[model samples]
Target: MLKLELPAKYEALRQRVRAFVDELLIPIENASTAGTDLKPEIRARLEDEAKKRDLWMLHVPPEFGGQAGDMFSKIVIWQELGRSIAIPPRRWAVFGPDPGPILYQLAEHQREKYLWPVLRGEKKVAFAQTEPGAGADPAGMSTTAVRDGDHYVINGRKRFIGFGDEADFIQVVALTDPAKRARGGISSFLVDTDTPGFRVVRQLETMMIDRPVELEFVNVRVPAENLIGREGDGFRLAQSWITEGRLARHGARGAGVIERCLELGVAYANERTTFGSKLADRQSIQFMLVDMYQHLYQLRLMLYDTARRFDAGEDIRTESYLCKYFGDESAFHAADRCMQIHGAIGLTTDYPIETFWKQARSFVITEGPTEVMKMVVARKVFEDFTKTA
Candidate 1:
């Protein structure tokens, strides 16, 4: 298990981010909620301010111009950012530069070309692993990359790519050899958005907080050098990336939604009155609030425990599945109860509670569906017990 010894500098970093959000991000989000777009100039200005405050790319390694934050520290930062209505954009600006699955298997030139630019905020990256036909079973993907001289010509369509419209580069998975399938036939490539034949088919507007896109690669050509790692290691690399990413999502984002639900519930209980008495005084409301608190407490402990284990270099696939399942279920339940407590106002866009409820619902399907996670848990349990027996 990972220990929770906070470095002396952790508190200072936390305070800096909290102050930045309070003074800058909250105002921008409020304007956005009023149907005003955060103009590019305004975003740039805030980005400059954030950079000046040394708050950029806190999640990446220090060598990559990041603060090299640990899992626990990232949990703190993400939770603080989650309190605001504009968390998606603000958090993206601060931590978006960090490399994902591609980093683990980056070629030398690829790292300098793609990873470095991301860390410096000069470029944005997105992963294109999912397709319309390959939602859960990635190996079932039909996206093909055929070798042509010194380059590979990729032709396929990827859907629901998060932040795809604004990404400077995308890491794509393709079948190099269908005979081996995922065993040694899958390959990954770094494709520049400006490359010929690469096009954004459409921007997909979802119920969640972020905007995703569908991309079409019509004979997109990537040089051999753009390939990441060995030709057949893409599946393994993707698994590692998703396992770590899912943990972060469950630990940080899920925890944040739960905390926000509790906050809104508490505030509502104090202000709203029913039957000539304050809602806080009602036994039913009190019981619901207590339930929300209990859920949050249990989820946080599980999240932190899993995160600590991950940071300690332990294999946490099973734990991550458990975290993802419980995290989504707990947050959704809390958000539902919160909405029930708020009555009609909860359904309206007038408050952030409605938005939180939508985001929680998305969590149930995003990283891995709740059903898939449970299956993973059962499989792991069966394997472990069988070994002991």
Candidate 2:
């Protein structure tokens, strides 16, 4: 019941995205990117070009004025875009709102005011959940939002939120009942950035070029209408988003990086001479190349299988974690091997391998760390093992 090949319907679009990334983006990436930031003119022009090809808004539903590329199609396109170090998270987000699926829970008027504008790139929204002390432990959060008649008074500190520094508003998760925590007391709220008492504490810079930030909420009052879904649905809703991200965010990106590393490594080995012979002739380098290829081969099967299951509407929590965990580990391994092939040259920015290595390192820690992913996998294993016992 698994479709391993690219679906026929998406083949054209896949190739188009692939060509755009390989021929256009990668070739000009070094020149166009000022350090880690893409030049404004280049970003604008690329978006405009994607628009001309009708390639924008690939993930939204058709009813929402999007092309409605399913989970499988997203995998296909992102793998290609991921091969390029220069492309941002959303490759086809040129013309509209590429807000994650979280916005689907918005009310009609809320969508009109918040979601639609974001899909159009007219506004940006950030998700706030990880607290100052609660990175992987969502249930350990201390932020609280108490109801105050017409509005909820929120006070909390959220750390390492991507896009928080630039977003017009934020989707926040708060503890309404400390006794229940993630069980039945947590809630989601949308708070505008300019709301009194809401403040950006600082931008957190890492080896990653695009910096994320921390935010402090001091008695920030949000209207009752700003609540997403019903109270206590926060953790449930956030789980869906997090689980989905386990596949798309680091998984797909890692797969692309793996593929690129192998490509560059093989080419360099064949062309470079070492110790009076082609580097490819050395067994040490040959074994690494072979191992890299095998890893990608197996990764492709796992990636497509998991994606097919997701599109078929199956519960993929365990499978997604496994895929993401493998991706996080395997990508860095592949990059390190490739860099070994490139020797010291790979350590410098003159080559993209250095950046790829850092990005792969970053992937291991983002979304959910490999350790958390392993925890999810272990839970599923124990549950299945004990079934009917």
State the C-alpha lDDT per candidate: 0.76, 0.81
Global lDDT for candidate 2?
0.81
Clash pairs detected, candidate 1: none
TM-score of each: 0.89, 0.95
**lDDT tens readout by residue for model 2, 1-389:** 12346667767877888777876688875576664456788888888777777777766778778887467776776677778777654233443567777787788868987888887778888989998889888889999999999999999999988889889999999998999998988988889999999999998878767677899999999999998888898898788777667776667777888888888998899999977999999999999988877777777788788888988999888888887878778888989999999999888877778777887888787778889888878887888788683
lDDT of 1 at 216: 95
lDDT for residue 220 in candidate 1, whole number 0-100: 96
Give candidate 2 regions above 4 Å deviation. Answer: 1-4, 89-92, 387-389
Tell me the tens digit of each residue's lDDT in model 1 across 1-389: 11334456766776787798778876666444322224566667776887788787777666555676467666667656766666452234444455764574576777788877776668888888889998777888889999999999999999888877888989898999989878999888889999999999998777665667899999999998888887887888778777765666654666667777788888999999888998989999989888877776776677677777777988878888887778778778878888998999988876777777777788788767888888878987888788652
Candidate 1: lDDT of 130? 88
Candidate 1's TM-score reads 0.89
